[model samples]
Target: MITGPLCRAARALTELSREKLAALSGVDEHVIELFERRIAAPDANVVAMLKSTLEDMGAVFIPEDRRGAGVRLKFTASETKRIATLESEGGLIRGDDVP
Candidate 1:
């Protein structure tokens, strides 16, 4: 059985070279690279953006706290609203029609 690549949380989120992810996420390239290489870990908000961006790419995040215990998905109520607002602003989902 061949196991798929299991990247670190940061790597999984960026899914691109540090330089590219930096441009896409509007974060510093060095900082993103450091996080992926385990030299640093981003703060909660940065991580949350990375996670949400990855979701659009069909990638899922499993918190390290819940690793190795089967599928682990963390859902934050606030994050959902943030995503909704973001989508509304981007016009991907219409919020005006609902409320």
Candidate 2:
């Protein structure tokens, strides 16, 4: 669980929903929420997964060390919907929180 400003910005700029992001990233949505909330540190794999997913959708995610560059994410509403559907359809999400 690694949280950083760069990661937060990426989450905000991306169209992927938290649940879908986590599922597609092979992580729990709660962990994705943690990263968005900046409450937990996202490990290298988590960062890598997120970056890869974004890149596949035509977004360029810069690592924390490379945040100074003009990296950007380009996604339309339809693309977002598509990505969400892809992730959700795969049934990657697994959670049964009682709280």
Candidate 3:
């Protein structure tokens, strides 16, 4: 179940404005605003649509557990592949100094 905060966090993680999200999800912009503000509650179907839209835009909703619910941006396929290749290079590891 997605909560108001979770939806807002996911939207932020995905860098989507309410207008954009509503356009993509076929949800009303006002409804999104109300939901995020915790001023109103949409039906389960609306929540599902929002979640699906966010997920499609790379927002991954973390299930609630000991750490609690959260949202994160998922890496795209190319990024994942590049990361795997870089890791498999197996070169010497060193820490860089930050100034």
Candidate 4:
């Protein structure tokens, strides 16, 4: 299930405008706007279409876990290595300083 924020994040990750997403998913642009605004819940079919379109575009939806639900990009090995390099260089945080 795609939550509002997750849907928004997926769109952002894919560099998709609301109009583009609507065109791809066959959902109305206004409905997508309302969904992202958290003002309305779309029908299950709409949700499915959004998810399918995003997945086809390389967005993976993480199921709710202890940390929470989220969306992530499906990266290639070189991209994964680049992210690992950044993390190893202290470009990312692991929360070790949290009290």
- Pick the winner on TM-score between candidates 3 and 4: 3
Question: Residues 27-96, candidate 4, lDDT per residue (tens digit)?
Answer: 9999998998899999988999999999988899999989999999999779999998977996655668
Instruction: Report the lDDT tens digits of candidate 3 across residue range 3-57.
Output: 8899999999889999999999999999999999999999999999999999999
Q: In model 4, where do residues sit more than 4 Å from their true spots?
A: 76-99
Clash list (residue pairs), candidate 2: 1-40, 1-41, 1-42, 2-41, 2-42, 3-41
Number of clashing pairs per prediction, in order:
0, 6, 0, 0
lDDT of 2 by residue, 1-99 (tens): 224555556656666677767777787888767766778867888777876765665566544455353347777789899999987887666798878
lDDT of 3: 0.93
Ranking by lDDT: 3, 4, 2, 1
lDDT of model 1, residue 82: 92
Sort all candidates by TM-score, best to worst. 3, 4, 2, 1
In model 4, residue pairs whose N, Cα or C atoms come closer than 3 Å (at least 3 residues apart or on different chains), thus clashing, are none
lDDT of 3 at 57: 97
Best by lDDT: 3
Q: What is the lDDT of candidate 4?
A: 0.91
What shift in Å separates residue 68 of candidate 2 from its native position after superposition? 3.3
Clashes of 4: 0
Off by over 4 Å in 1: 1-15, 63-99
Error of 4 at 68 (Å): 0.3
